[model samples]
Target chain A: MLARLARARTGGLAALVAVVALLPLALTNNYHYEVAIVVGLNAIVCVGLNLLIGYAGQISLGHAGFYGLGAYGSAILTVRYGWPPAAALVASTAGAAALAYLVGRPILKLRGHYLAMATLGMGIIISIVIATEDRVTGGPDGMAVAPFAVLGFTLAGERVWYWVIGAALALAVWLSLNLIDSPAGRALRALHGSEVAAQVAGVDPARYKVLAFVISAVFAAVAGSLTAYYAGFITPAKASFLHSIELVTMVVLGGLASTFGAVIGAAVLTTLPQVLTLLKDYEMMVFGAVLMLCMIYLPRGLVPTIADALARRRR
Target chain B: MSTFTLKHFTRAALAASLAFGAAAAMAQAPIKIGAFLSVTGPAAFLGDPEQKTLELYVERINAAGGVLGRKLQLVSYDSGGDAEKARTFAKRLIEQDAVDAIVGGSTTGETMAVVPLVEQAGVPFVSLAGAVVIIEPVKKWVFKTPHTDRMACEKIFVDMQARKISKIALISGSGGFDKSMRGQCLKVAPNYKIEVLADETYGGGDTDMTAQLTKIKNTAGVQAVLNAGFGQGPAIVTKNFRQIGLTVPLYQSHGVASKEFIKLAGPAAEGVRLPAAALLVAETLPDADPQKKVVVGYKRAYEERFKQDVSTFGGHAYDGLMLVVEAMKRAGTTDKAKVRDALEGIKGFMGTAGVVNMSPADHMGLDLTAFRMLEVKNGDWALVK
Candidate 1:
């Protein structure tokens, strides 16, 4: 176990799986299970977002728009066209990936705040389209999704959903870890260090950037689809700029380059709001305070800071 | 490990034991009414009052020896105007708190999100939202207090016919509430012999609605301009319409039936009319009117407690809670099915909104008569008559 811990990926995943397996013991009721499931879903999105922002050094301010498109795409196809839910999920994910490719091709060329603004504009456009196309999207009221089923088995109850979402989150983390270690991942990191330098080193900056953008979007779309099915409802709010900001916050607060940091960030931020509800009106105030304190003390983010502390202690 | 740690641990343990003792001593559980509202979100204005109303009534009911000789307990959560939060809270309310009934849902979206859960939980739910879909295709466990958008459109159209004004221009926000009202108006316009000259839409967050208002202004033969939306969007439109110098009688949907709209639009809101609950103009209502007494009483008590003006949204919560209480009293038990049955059978229950008459077919138990056509004059709501 000590040897495995030295190699973070295998140890971190084993710990995550162990936690997921044992979490139900502490979850006394459906509400706990429900909140846990939501945490997992958010973690899945943050994991992908980390790959884009942390690994590729690209910032996306409109990731929630892709998430919304995924949700609405699957919802519309299933609820309106009567396509099977599983098939619709795949189609919507592919659609979101395709959209990210088209939108990212030009916008990803820009860096820093320009890219942020462009993504923000893209999100606003998608939100407006979803809200205005009342005939298909059900306007701002949003439409209900049919029960999520694969084959003849239906997904129901918070307990069942918790496992499903947990597995998805685990898979997202695993895939992200594998990608970060691969040659393509090296290309992304190389460009992230210096675009001009990476080009001199024969890494196609635009190609890698767009690839990361599309892959991250696909992750968001899948997460969005799962959320829609889990919630049994989808609203334009899912794709709103607020959700996009929240996704970005989770990635940054977790730690840019750490995969496990993404999961920790998603878990803390998601669960914090639920716990903060005990404070009622002061919830937002305290939530802001916590974020500020976290940034001030552990600037590298929760997981990475803790890991750094552990390594130093061992030395 | 240290003397300081030992001292603090001892203090913590003492505190926990005292709390446990206090909780255990209160053996007889109060009858819990679970509520979730958009108390601190984009729709905080709606939920804040609804939550206050529930708190106010629960206190009053408990002071009056509670319902069915048991103290009334209100368990409330702020949904923050999100559907997912509302669902999670609803589940907690039912499974964990074991609330006897629920009276909440400040927004159309929140109510819809919890409808399925309330049905499955078999709890009596009286919603404060105005969406027709909440009560329509009626779910067995749910009822609502506010007048539906359909009724609001009918009331507005009736007033238009009375004035002999037919050609109207509709400008609405692209929201669920606005879209539903627009759809209802389009479906029912022909019944009132009204022709829609042009229909325009603006995004909810859009600050300048001058473009939509400009198109409406250019449409020939447009006798009345109706804005079907809630929040500041309609106020902006009203401001722009007046700024653009369109003299046509400006009408709004019930969604904007608040003093905030008048305040937001300022002088531009003058002469603008909409159908609203009788509560808004309760003081002006004649002594002989049935709703006047109920409305005035609630308005006075609520204002005194909260130290703020009463709103129609709060009044919806007032009516919903009282209706559920009345049904429980009629049923003589807190059993979910009995309360639901009694609620369905209730009739002539005078509420602040209107005289409610629930049935198996109609869960809302109110109609067009529940809404009053009111106009803004001198920055205040006044009866259209």
Candidate 2:
């Protein structure tokens, strides 16, 4: 059974790699590439977020705050202080991780809705600060981020960005999968199943919870930094409460505790809007309906429900 | 017999050549105008009408004989006020659609986000968003239709100077437009010999400004008050100003030039003044004014078609589409480079805003005269003159 589980993990990663590599064959234009890039970035964030919400069973409504911090941090560092894009991205991601570590300890102590509210408040505060600081972040008007470059080779065009985001996404998925199979991952699952029981079983719930929070925040931050550079602009809206809710929704919709499910959730939610653009004024109405139907029918989330069906069919 | 055969053959060849030439001319591809607007989000109020105006005019122009004998095609996407989405749509417009020009960016953030993309693509972009940053330093490929917050400040200051009111108090909201306008007013107050007595700001979601107003009211030698904001905040400020019974002149930025402001503020809005596009006062403008014909025509057509009150935001889009079309006409071809040159060389062209005089140095190409001063009277907008 353990060998089968290991095979399944490797199989999922290989399948994801194949999809990313083969997606370009079907993409005939830059628009397709652009949407794919956006999907990959969102998937990277959702992967990290899945580790916390899916594996550890921690709810965060302010993960977008970490994402926004990474975006604005890189934007300000590169645009204002003239730091190299690579250095700025690394520094911003580090900054967000440090912040998540500090806040995660106390915030993670609360259970259920209290934790959600705390994260929501943190996100709102970050959004307001970004909007208010017009001198630095350019406020709500947003500021341009310099093109992402490394070793004097600037990353330009949608095709180039597609490969960059694709590789990053694959790496993120690999890391999450590895983390899930480790002892720490088991401790997180134990905490999720029952915090009191987890403590009795010799797993430190507090440390593991904080660890999950910090890791998830690092994922969001790295994705956010990449987003700013890829789009060439950053706005306070990146950190808005609405965006946080959207990210959380992607994780839940993809199926909590399932790594591949998180990725599938990100892809569907990201591409749905682009497809619904054809509906024009009725786009929002239809989008809401689709989400409702999915929740009603596939309650276990998209991936888990389908996976369960396949197992039953084989039986 | 030989002479008859030669004559008949020459006539048939002439007819075939003529038909072929006409078919080639008729088959010319339409000029594609791309746009990305926040048509269904927080900024929908701005983008919805702008979208309507573009669709209305594009159809009208095609019916009245398309520019340079080719129909205009507008490919617009709803960005929903998301800057990242706006950038993505813009890329699609440029890279996939290969449009001749772009003419929409409903919010400053959206416009600013797409500026680099448009500039890099070398496509002419006429933004409908109101911000000095869109045009300041004059990006080569970018242009905007609405008057900047800085110009609005100058126009308001000029009106204050005319009234001999030098000491003014400013109460602004914390939104991007409010802050930018407040900053601009402070920057140019010295040029107009105006002194800012009190500068107060409220949060974006603040409902009550009574405390801020009372402080301004008690300030010594305050001749007028300017509220640099838009949305419900300005209307709330106007009501609060009246509730506090401050008799000083209340000036609002062009941000809230819509009739909704008057309706929201109720009877208290009666004496409030603002600088707005000529479209708002189309009926009140003198017949001799160059913009009177264009603004009145646009306002009537838009209202007749959409069955809604005409807005300056929509007028900005009208100006944007018309400018691009006019540039195409002047250039006499759909060549992107030539159309860009023609757009820059436009002078004395009457638009909803004013007489647009685009140049390499000034992409926006509207001066203080473009903004008309108006005050609320009998619960409607009245010409300030």
Best by TM-score: 2
Which residue pairs show collisions in model 1?
A: none
Candidate lDDT scores, in order, read: 0.88, 0.90
Model 2 chain A worst lDDT run, 10 consecutive residues: A1-10
DockQ of each: 0.64, 0.61
TM per candidate? 0.90, 0.93
> What RMSD does each model have against the real structure?
4.4, 6.1
For model 1, what is the alpha-carbon lDDT of residue B216?
A: 87
What is model 1's interface RMSD?
A: 1.6
Which residue pairs overlap in candidate 2's backbone? A54-A257
- Judge candidate 1 against the unseen true structure and give its global Cα lDDT, from 0 to 1: 0.88
Model 1, A1-315: lDDT tens digits are 432432478887888899899999999988889889988988989999998899888889899998998899999999999999999999999999998898888876765556677789999999989988989988766788998998899999888898999899889988988998899999999988988899899998778888888989999999999988988887788899999999989988988888888888898988898788788778899999999999999898877777777777788
